[model samples]
Target: MSTRRFFAVALVVSLLVAGVASYYASSHPDGLEYVAEQTGFIDSAEDSATADSPLADYQTSGVDDARISGGLAGVIGVVVMLVLSTGLFWLVRRRGTDDVDSDDARPEHARQSEA
Candidate 1:
């Protein structure tokens, strides 16, 4: 299949799985929190800068619904990571690619095209 079709199928499949998993997820604290509680460290846990973050605790502030909050947090984390990685790559690339037309470091085809 073409790139578009492939990506579409992947997205649909991923969404379907996510929906099913979300529907079946337990409302209890996740593995880490459970471990912390069992180990007697949960009470000592305090908020980090992450605590104030929009996606903190795998939930948004004021969200009463568990599944929605977790899903929203996951989505937000994905978006934030995508944006951050793209931004970092662009910044690094911009410095190198900005003057390809005028840069002597470029290859013959680029120099010829620019000329």
Candidate 2:
């Protein structure tokens, strides 16, 4: 498939998974939190540095409705991830192009001398 089509599908899937499926997820702790509780150290865990952020606990703060808050948080998270990944990929692509251009600009003798 074309890159644009692939990315479009990926974005849609990501949004659906995060915004819709996330609402059905179990509220009970599953991984590390569960382990900590079972081991009797759950209380010792420190709050995340971002604990006070509006979207801290998988839900938007002060949103009133639980479903809406969680869904909005999920959508916002997906958008932020997409933007960051796109920027990182763009930078890497540009860096690769620069490397190729610089290599091409060097004379054959200069290229050989660097080896």
Candidate of highest TM-score: 2
lDDT per residue for candidate 1 within 1-115, as digits (tens), equals 8998996786666555553465476779889999999999999997797678776766767778877777666666555665798799999888768775458777889779967
- Score candidate 2 by TM-score against the native: 0.85
In order, the Cα lDDT scores of the candidates are: 0.72, 0.95
Find the 10 residues in a row with the least total lDDT in model 1.
14-23
Steric collisions counted per model: 0, 0
Q: List candidate 2 segments past 4 Å from native.
A: 108-115
Predicted structure 1, TM vs. truth: 0.54
**Candidate 1 clash figure, as a count:** 0
Clashing pairs in 1: none
Cα displacement (Å) at residue 59, model 2 = 0.6
Residues 2-61 of candidate 2 have per-residue lDDT tens digits of: 999998999999999899999999999979999999999999989999999999999999
